[model samples]
Target chain A: MCDSEGSCHVLLLEDEPMILMDLEFAAEACGCNALCATSVKQAMKHLDSERPVRVGILDVNLGEGQTCEPVARELERRGIPYILHSGDLDRQNETVRSLNAQLIPKPANANHVISTAMECVGRKCG
Target chain B: MTDDEQERSRPSQAMGNPKDFDDSPERFRDENPDARFGGASEVLFEQAMAQTRMAICLCDPNKPDLPIVFANKAFRNLTGYDEAEIVGKNCRFLQGPETDPEPVRKMRQAIENEDVVVVELLNYRRDGSSFWNALHLGPIYDSEGKLKYFFGSQWDVSDVRAARAEEHYAREMARELSHRMKNMFSVISGIVNVTGRMRGIESEAQEINDRVQALGRAYETTLDDASAGRIEIGQAIRAILSPYDVGESHLRLLGNGIRVPFAAVSSIGLVLHELAANATKHGAWTRDDGLVEVDWQEKGEDEQRVVEVTWREKFGPKVTIPADAKGGSGNEIIDRLLRFSNGCIDREWHEDGLVAVARVPIWKAS
Candidate 1:
């Protein structure tokens, strides 16, 4: 897609180490560049660096008992579309669920995760 | 002492000639001041002791048998022994199979050490009836600093202890019931989520979630009404069907308000939601041309006020009643709902429309 680098910059905000690895490989395989953050604070640092990011995939819950709800709210305010990735959508705390985002459950197929991310980016950027 | 002579002569000294020996009150007082002072006090003390509910015993400390020098009516009533039977025996006769040994042992140690003892035990009554007894015993000393006697009192407290236990059980039951209800709600939410995913599209899935969430809300609102022991049918129907309406005009609501019980409100609400959802998808409200007319009125005399809710469809696409589709599941839920209220459902089909009629009782709120 590009001369010698990735096609587009993708930011992923997932907490699990294995899930983060899966997403990075999936995004790179889809001809997109990937930047990973394990928490909302780290994601904000990445966003502050003036890097061009076309899309985001946000894990709704951080394993350390924190939530990405405020991060998702900030993304919505910044006009950046994000897809929700959660394994505990039906079982997690109710307050975190009231946020607005398209939800995709996990241990999801890598292809569906990548495609949903692309679709969300296309909806926001186009 | 000749019996006939003693009977005849006794009246001569004490009863016959009181004026001959001590006619003047001043002379009698001068001869025996202690008798006048002590007899009056002793009679008053006896009167007060007889009226007390607390078991009172006066024990001789010098005697190891602890022979009871005095026992009140309450003591006789508590130990099943009258004055003649108990006055010469040890006060420990009250201890038996029903008596708790720990407090009794502590009480004996306290008494041997000349310390006041306040402890709980089980003591037998006159009829061998056992009761929880709170015993308080203290030593009484004479002016010469010698231990004169021990005074003991017992109280019955079985009813108070039983009432406390009952109260504890009630609170435990309330907490357990609340916990169970919360888990139940979570399980229902899980079912809604899983079922929503199996639907055809996102909108359909969202719709199902919205309706199911509304069902959860309806259950809450109806529970409030049920706790108050009355349910307003019109208010309930408006709340139950709100998710499916989406501010549409083809769904018309017509009914005067009627009150029923919690069971009726819940059962009827489940049945109505099923029918309304089916109608929204297949019968009326499926197309712009279709219409649903809902109405309710009294159907019988006396206490039998039949409230009929009709779901009528007209001018829709050529309709085929899904005999196995909505009918089967909907009827099963409806039957379960009406089992307690003695209700039924009737369906009729004509060339132009399909109609469902639910007849339920107007159970009065208590």
Candidate 2:
């Protein structure tokens, strides 16, 4: 169950479909609505939709030699909080660090993802 | 040891003439007085230099431009230059735009100190081609200890350098492969963990197996055209549903060639598998004469491009909507998958069978 604020919409950007599904399921389990996108372009479309986004979760690699940095920047520009879930652990990306977003490496549990998204929205997980 | 000492240690026959050796007392005593003034030794020395495979050159240090005073046959052959064309020119003529300046600067320092130096650098030939040259240069002094000439020997090492570059590329590829493998394992572990927690062990194991197979199919698609980073949507669907096709006629697939993004292949395969499995148990695939038709097409333009897929089934026993149809796990899985892809699925039940339509955003292959 989510915090007292009921369900808030969270933008989810991940290239891997299964992982994207897992994140969506996690957000739903925590009583949050998930608006998912499998690529940066799709995520931008979601952003442009005027949807009320309380928070965001992003996977670093969007496949086809693309990344989610553009979406992350847009989220930052809008002052929305986000978490980065990535399989690339070796990269010390300055952009991710400078954004001060929490980074959860791949193979993360749904509980952790849910908790991180809740925390980004200023909610506490019981 | 000093050069004089090294010269004296050599056999008198190895020396061209007594005058050619530095005036070390030992060399003077070792020379054959009978042959001291003869030109026979000079001819033998010239023959030896001409026959050797190593490119050899002698540069006159006293000359204003340090011109090459002598060049061996191998030197002429290696550089595609005639002896007459190279004899009076500085060896720097072999350098061109691609040559790195660091080694040239090092060579300059060595020449200033009159020190022996070996450098591997790019050098141009008379034909305007380039070769990796391993050049060794040392000073040759006269009896008075004056630097008379700079002795240079060159070997074409282009093949060796090329091999080293190939080795570097292979190492980079190996690192990339390792990183990808690690990520794959992580994904597999996550699947096992999550599925086990959500379902009992037996069901978890089965789901894990199915998901792994889905991943395998995705990899097969990638291997088909490793460079494209895409797979045909129809091919991916066929691969997943082929196992359940039973009689080939039961399943029909039609599509205008649509290349799905590589990242979406595995998930798409999983969705197809789930749909086919449900049909096999309770839908059209339950009966011998039942039929299913799946088709997909791309619509919209530019950034708005979307893929629309429809699954229509008929000829099975009269369809009945189960009580849990609205909230079933199968529906949940389908919803999650479609939503993740920025798509939606609409399911309609008719007297004949079931119809499902899915519209998903897509990135066309550039």
Count clashing residue pairs in model 2: 0
Could you give the DockQ of candidate 2?
0.10
Name the weakest run of 10 consecutive residues (lDDT summed) in model 1 chain A. A1-10
Q: Give candidate 2 misplaced runs (Cα > 4 Å).
A: A1-5, A90-101, A120-122, B1-85, B92-121, B124-130, B134-160, B186-366
Clashing pairs in 2: none
Docking outcome class, model 2? incorrect
lDDT of 2 at B234: 77
Compared with the true structure, what per-residue lDDT tens digits does model 1 show for residues A41-119? 9988876666666777887767566878777777777777788776554435474467767887543444467788888
Per-residue alpha-carbon lDDT of candidate 2 for residues B138-254, written as tens digits (9 for 90 to 100): 898866788878989999999999999997876566546544654574466556645664775635554555556555544544544445666677777776676678868899898
How far out, in Å, is residue A77 in model 1? Answer: 4.4
Every model's DockQ: 0.04, 0.10
Alpha carbon lDDT at B350, candidate 2: 81
Off by over 4 Å in 1: A1-73, A81-126, B1-187, B191-214, B223-227, B298-302, B319-327
Question: Model 1, B1-366: lDDT tens per residue?
Answer: 643233223322422432222112233235325224246665555444556667776677777767776665566566666556666677677667867678978887977999999987877765777777778888987667678778777777778778888977765654444333433443444444444444535345444544454455455445434545676777777767754665576667878777665666666677788777766766666777666667666577547866777767676667665566334555677766766677888777654467778888874533
At residue B171, candidate 2 shows an lDDT of: 55
Of the candidates shown, which would achieve the greatest lDDT relative to the real structure?
A: 2
